[model samples]
Target chain A: MIDPALGSLGAQIVLAASSDENHPPENIIDGNTETFWMSTGMFPQEFIIRFAESMKIALVTMHCYNVKTLKIEKSISDDATDFEAISEKEFEHTEGHLQTNDIPLNGTTATHLRFIVTSGYDHFVSVHRVSVE
Target chain B: MVKLRSRCLLVGDAAVGKSALSQMFRSDGAHFQKNYSMTAGVELVVKSVNIPETSDSVELYIFDSAGRETFVEACEKLWGQPSVLCLVFDVSSELSFSSCGRWLERVRAHCQGLHIPGVLVGNKSDLSSRREVETSVAQEWAQSQGLQYHETSAKEMENCEAPFLSLAQLFHALYQDRLQTIQNLA
Candidate 1:
């Protein structure tokens, strides 16, 4: 089965506080590794992604760059609020290519996923793509 | 000689030759990189345009932003406020041209209804055989959006300066108009 987090598979970016006309938050789920959603600036930037429907997720893979600390949260509710913590990790800095990492969810079921970028290797952090399996 | 500065936003869909056009304009047709790293974020390029037969000049801070939809929200924060807009699209791709409406709406919404002088640029004119957006159709749409339309080929450096130069002229004209109004009031 195809991952539901891919934009083509019906993942939706319900809310993004920062908006760049050229680089919208939709890039993270577009399923294109070459495209990305960049943070304009500051810490604690977050985006909410809603799946097509509630499904069990064993893992979530994110391809990003310059992200230092990432925190993932999930909710079974339809609305964006009431998120429960899933996992958080500090990424090692890498050069020349995107930092690809997977955060295991231990078979959690969620309708929405939240990614909070608490810090980054640089002033900005970009999320290229996100997938669920 | 009077000098003025304006922040000009270069916005459009990805792979529409925005970076190439900006680089060509900045380098005076002397530099066109064979390879371009997709602009991950905002790339700033400044150029001074001299008004013909006058010492007066306008300095443009061109913010060439990434065109992918996903990066737009982040890019808008970096845009701050812009003095002018240069909206671009690929003439060969109908999708790129259609996306122009969304780009313009997003920009206008960001500015909160303040009128910004802008132009619609159809890039990749060299690919005439593959063209999906015709000039008359594009011009009509641009007119409806309150913008002047121009076509360009960044690869061949064809008519690359018209859009930016037109923006500079419009800005200069506005400055002159404001100055005249003040003088007449005095």
Candidate 2:
């Protein structure tokens, strides 16, 4: 079972709303909790992850820090366009550790998944890692 | 082939030529505006400086914040754990020179007492006749504060790069010390 196989399956953040040299978007799929992709102090930040091939996804789990609301979307097309909303969550604030969440997708199949950070506990938010199973 | 990026902050009292010094260094002394407006918030400018005798370079993301007391509170949110500092003061204004301690305290407080490498700059050296802050006095204060001091004339575009270059070197030296410690641990 490739339980956390986003990075190993060749998924990458093809698009990001904000970019910081120190906290590049690639950290989201690096599968390392120590490194995270951080926002440069603004809201409505988003990043789109594209898998190498279309696959069945039963659940989407992630580790986030200071994130308040997160919305997940999926696209079946070849490109990362025309996304349909799957779920949105208001995270519980945590201190000294990340807020872990697993949103069930129920056997959804897609090539691209987009994660939108609508708001955050602080001015900036960090998405540590995301996995699909 | 080492590329490092760091956050650098410019803080001081108003009209101390912080913006002018930043522009001069960014443009390589080619552009010094005759009539410059005050910075209301934070302005970011990224520049790369190569370390001498090494292929490594540090990309300095300079956050030029407004010098006015009213705007400083809001500007702190944008600073975001600064790695280096450029404390500026006008040479002709004794009041501004005396406020250096306050500015330094604010920066250190925001950093949560981390060791931030930095340089103290006395701008407006062209106003030598009207200078109220002497080189010896400024140097002495900088030494007491554990910072190296340099004076520059932003209007005349002279000695503008010295302070920033010095800051880059200091950051590089700190990185070397950390690398050495890790190597010894290994």
lDDT of 1 by residue, B144-186 (tens): 9999999999899999999999888876665565434322322
| Total clashing pairs in model 2 | 0
lDDT of each residue in A53-91, candidate 1, tens digit only? 999999999998878888999999988779999899999
Worst 10 residues of 2 chain A by lDDT: A34-43
| Candidate with the greatest DockQ versus the true structure | 2
Q: Give fnat of each prediction, in order.
A: 0.00, 0.00
Instruction: Show the lowest summed lDDT stretch of 10 residues, model 1 chain A.
Output: A35-44
Query: lDDT of model 2 at residue A53?
Result: 87
lDDT of 2 by residue, A71-116 (tens): 9999999888899999899999876667899999999999899999
Candidate 1 local distance difference test against the native: 0.83
